[model samples]
Target: MFLNHSREVLRLLTSLQADLLILEENELLFFNYFFSFLSSVLGLSITIWIWMLNKKQNRRKDRIYKQLSGTNALLIIWVILMIISRFGSILPIVLFGTPGYDNHLNLYEEYWILFVLIPIVVFMQSWFTVRLVYQAGRWIFSTFLLCMLTAFVLQLTTTVSQEKLNLAYHQRFERDYNYIDQEIRIAKEKYGIDYSEQTVEILKKQVTESSVKQVESVKKAFFGDRPVTLDTIILQKIIIRNYKEGGRYYYKRNAIENWRYALPIDILKQLSYFDQNAKETKELLEVLKEMIDLVNTPEIHWQEYQNFTETERRRSLGARYNIPDPLIEQLKKVQTRLLEDDLYSDFFKNLQAIKDRE
Candidate 1:
């Protein structure tokens, strides 16, 4: 009888856990939709380029081409649908821009005009390129030939370069995401962010504000006060660290990967856009400094010392005077405040109102 009651309790716990996960999973969907959209963009771009390059209109080849016509249609349709899906995916956020499941998109809208233009351009380019390919030896329209050749080369280079860039981009994206995830695990386990319900607007503002100021500081240091040569050296170091450290600390990657963007966090909080007196500001400046150090080093990851908590637990509160007891907890409380803010709710409510009006 006791075992049966225990089983029921465990089952209830599981269900409750799943329900909570489902609730929190909304933020994660943006990454999914974006990654899918990027994949489609890259895939369609490559397909269109290939079709444009290979097309020919000779009679015998046409007959042979008819057999492969289904393949071409399939490819074209795939590209078109993917494009449409991506466009459809982004519309909710940019237009009405709701949050959560009904939102069905991201709060931070990422736009690409190429999504609409590519399909139309693809078909047109395919038609023209087919004619050009067949007339390579003959004199086709001079402008048509020039345009065709240029499109051909441009398409080839763009597809190749985009793939390489996306490759680097995704690698860094995943790396930084994992890095943030690692930190979150620390935040939850060692600190107490996971337990807090106070996560909301002020928290978001803090992170966003911090990041923007950090970037702005770097920009000013490089372009405003420091010489171009000095900035170039810093940029070179950043690039080298990106390559060497697998980008554990880079900004475009690490900074963006943060679940809570420091820029918007700072913005919402109305923190100083720039800290004029970094030397004097102790509490706030220290946090900013850690972030800046992370950005600059581009290699050093914030790692919680293994057995840190365990070691802490072994001692009494005042048993260890050297280590600060509240520092770890203080850091975690700050993190929690960032996560559970009411800002998104207010933002979403306003957006939905506008959407309803429309």
Candidate 2:
């Protein structure tokens, strides 16, 4: 019977492990639901077993009854002290804004003394006396507490482990994002193009305001006494706006439409269109090559956008901008030619294989 019970317990525990294995990263909602249900079932089972064990012991009527002795009082005192010590340790953690269950194992470590004394308390108590019901109740409550605490500890471990992995992933993402930003800046500098969010906002204000003085004030606040030509301002506005909207149009296919609004494409087109003279065409080609490099970058994963269907690309954030179809077609042709000659041919092909579900 003991062997069968042990096997049953082991099976339940194994099932719980399997449930935990299926839980994905940062998914606390489902994790809590499963953990709570399993622990409750386990706790109730143990509580029932303990009640049955106490009932069997109740059959022994020869068991002596005694008054609350010094040893009992001393044991109770020790238990109280153990609880106080545990709470004392936890208070600082709570005050510092850490959740009580964040480090569930710490509860065990802090109150190990209390757990050691529980069995002793059970053995010393008189099972035949009126205290039998109270003792059973305490046992049931303790069993439930241990079961839930174990579940909480396991949940914490899984969550913390996933958080660490995500931290590393985000760190790598930021590094790649910064690298792309730097490349975009260099390309803009090469073409004598200057653009930023502040600049765009400033230009918008200037366009809306009727007062020339207010516009000059805004320009001075941004540029700080530097002379800026109206042509330069218009070009900067175009470059900044196109880079952002165009990037969303050409790339960011895998991302949600609303979220893709935050992502701006590289300033490749702005540099290409800055000076279309024959003398600058060679330099323009270099800028185009840089754009191609940005697109093919394995780290940025821009292929996801390239793999997007014509409908998806056309339905981008900049779809309303109505970028010239001729210019768009020419850029695509140049990009295709560049990819054919590039060493990362395999990478580009892999991108093509990533068909958009949309």
Best TM-score among the predictions, by candidate number: 2
**Best lDDT among the predictions, by candidate number:** 2
Off by over 4 Å in 1: 1-24, 58-196, 199-305, 310-358
User: What's the true lDDT of residue 356 in model 2?
Assistant: 17
TM-score of each: 0.21, 0.25
For candidate 1, write residues 261-303 as lDDT tens digits.
1232332232233343322122222333332222222121226
Stretches of candidate 2 above 4 Å error?
1-136, 140-160, 171-175, 180-358
Worst 10 residues of 1 by lDDT: 349-358
Task: Please provide the root mean square deviation of candidate 2 (C-alpha atoms, Å).
Answer: 17.4
lDDT of 1 at 178: 46
What's the CA error at residue 80 for candidate 1, in Å? 17
